[model samples]
Target: MGETYGLLSLLPIAVVVITAIITKKVIEPLILGTVVGAILLYGFSFFPNWVGDLLATMSDPDVVWTMVIPALFGILIAMFGQSNAGTAFRELAIKYVKNKQNSLLATYIFGIIIFMDEYMNALLIGGTMRNLTDKFKVPREVLAYVTNSTGTPVSVLLPFSSWAVFLMGLYGSSELLDGDGFTTYLSTIPFMVYPMITLIIVLLFIFRKVPMTKYVKEAVARAEKGNLFPEGSGPDTEGFEDELEENSGNTKKPRLINFVLPIIVLVAGTIMFDMDLIIGVILAIVTCFILYRLNGTMTYSELFDTSVKGIQDMVELIVLIIAIFLLVRVNENLGTIEYVITSVEPLITPLLLPGITLLVVAFLGFTTGNYWGTMGIVLPIILPLTQMSDVNTSLVLGAMVSGGVFGSHVCFFGDAVTLTSASTQVSNMSQIRVSFPYALAGLILSFFIFLGLGLIV
Candidate 1:
């Protein structure tokens, strides 16, 4: 067996993490980490002849294609941009974002409404408000803050979200009204600490003049003076046709259908067939060509031409996805994630469980930068509570999720963290620095909350 603690096993992981932090790029770190691991396992004294096997595994098409589908799914979205779908969507959003106060309050209100599902709320609110939020220069993190804070707050309180279904699956209903374990799960929704506290914090941040950061402040200052950020970014007519191929924006209204129809296929197909997101996205990209042909946006030859054009639109987003993946992978391989989890387990105790849960989950989120993984582990493990008959599982699970989300909101390395930063054009550090105080306050309040919860339950 391989030595878990030896330098050979750790070198790859170390390089990956250090490089990721310094460069803030994901794919390069991931590729480099894998290469290092292969080197360690195959250095002359090691499995010298096994280099081929290691290489084959790393080159596995599945690894590359996993993201391909989601990327394609993203392309389907690009079609919308090329046409008029995005403009239509923006018009609808503007009606809602009417003003900053409306935008901020709406962010909270929707956060509460999307209670039935966390992921749905995340994408729906985040994507929908991209235009409006950008117009307001509301710092992508604030949108993230609102989306994240509300996503869980509502889910934990509502019995209809994926969590409810998960609990139902975990503890099959006994049929009677109160006999169902899910009901206990549902009742505990109020007990969820971090999300609830986070909701309150967002409300205050919105109503109060809580200065966020220089960039956020800049956005606000501009908005106060009535200005907007760059629009139709990523790529443009000049960027694609003039810069890339010397073509011009000739595709017309048909372009709109080319976008909408493909997205319907992607979202509907992915959700209905439960297809992998990456696969669904890829298919959507292909669909764009087919639809373009059918709708007259391009002929077969032009298909290749505009395909390049359409892809250019998503170039920044694609780069972001790859970078995020590499960084995430490298960090995982390095053992930083492992150390984060085990190091704090021993520190957990009954009296300290609530506060510690926040700290530990925050650290776990920082290390793994995962919202779901933190919940899965902390909720199941943690101190002496797995066997306690008197202890309510709801309170426990809530604390875990709350703490996890708190960390995720600020973890400069996590997916959501990166997504918010990249989409908003703010440096990752700016998002982190701006959001930290809010997350910390939520963590503190949640600690006391679980303390009171401990007695009530």
Candidate 2:
């Protein structure tokens, strides 16, 4: 462990955080940070080392699983979009969404229902419900907030999701824990304070039991005056607008089954396959293809084209995830987590471990904009600390998971934020600014909850 570069090990991630915040970009900063880490470790010969790490990280099985599952979901979502499934579902839900509060309620409900993955939740809910929210004079920021809030928070809280599966895989492989990964994860569910609290806050805001931040309040005022999108406040959504237009042109009467059946297959298949999301996603895609083909909604050629387009759309995000994996590898080689543990080891007693873990992991998650990557880096370090101090492992583990969700929730460049912005047509920065206050509230509340629980348990 002393082979670590000590204090210097912090350089790479610091570079990422500083550059990311300054530029409000994700991939470029990630790449630059990895390069900085490589240079720190290998000097001028860093090129070969960086390339090797990049290749190895890209080929990692877990990394592959993460990338592949989302890409498959992308293809499935494209099919759903092309077949007007989301539109059909939106129409069904719109009946109950006759007012502003009802629209928020409907969006919140659908966001929870599509909890297989954050990506799916954001894409489906934001795309499907934006128009409904718009009709009720709800700001796109509010829609983005509802969509983004429910995205990771819901997925992480639910045991049967890509988030839980990925975390379990990480925990399962760790030598520090004694139980099966799935069961251990289930143990942490009740203590996952940040996400659970976040969901509660989202509900409170939805029902007007809690006042929104000034940004959201202002946006709401703007929205009620016939401006659903604040000027210069969102992404360039012409492409999505075109897609929505094409979806609206579907000649067949929109059947609710076209939307609901594939998702049912996804959820049921996942349960049947021992919670492997890949199988569920593939099953959903196949179900969509067969259903669409038989219904004459899309031809074979059209289905193939849409499938390919979906994969193409995911290419950029996949590359971003790969960049995140590369940074994780660089951190490992630099012994970043080891350095952190070593530097802080003396202060990490049993009583403070959970709170400190949450703060540390949350900072890493926020700065890096990669919850899984941050978890991969920190959990190994955390498990050893939990073991050494005889702390309640489940409590600290819950804090770690909560911190990752908080980071993902608040990070401006996180994939959830980007997806929500795209689907809701809200700007990425604007979404972050609008949601950060709420996210911070969750973080502060969760920190105390972990601390209190640590002392009690």
1-457: candidate 1 lDDT, tens digit per residue: 2225344445655565566556655556545665665555445543443345444433444334422433343345334434433334445446767666677676666556444445445544555455666665564556666666666566656544444444442232111114444445655567667776677777877877565656556656655564443223232311112322211132354333554566566556556654344444556667877776666655676555555654564454344334333333333344433444455445445555555666777766666554443443344334234233335555665666667667667777765555444434444565566678777777777788778877766
lDDT of 1 at 174: 18
Tell me the lDDT of candidate 1: 0.52
TM-score top scorer: 2
Work out how many backbone clashes candidate 2 has. 1
Query: TM-score, each model?
Result: 0.52, 0.85
| Most lDDT-accurate candidate | 2
Give the 10-residue window scoring lowest on summed lDDT in candidate 2: 238-247
Worst 10 residues of 1 by lDDT: 237-246
Q: Give the alpha carbon lDDT tens digit for every residue of 1-457 in model 2.
A: 3255888887877787677667766678788989998999899999998899889987877677767866786788677767776667678887666789989888988888777678767767887788788788899988888889987888998876668767765665555688767788999998898999999999998998987788888988888898888667654652355554454566665767777898899889988998777888898889988998888888999899999988987787677777876776777778776677667778777888898889988887787686776676567667768887888888989999999998888887778787778788877777787889989888998888887998788
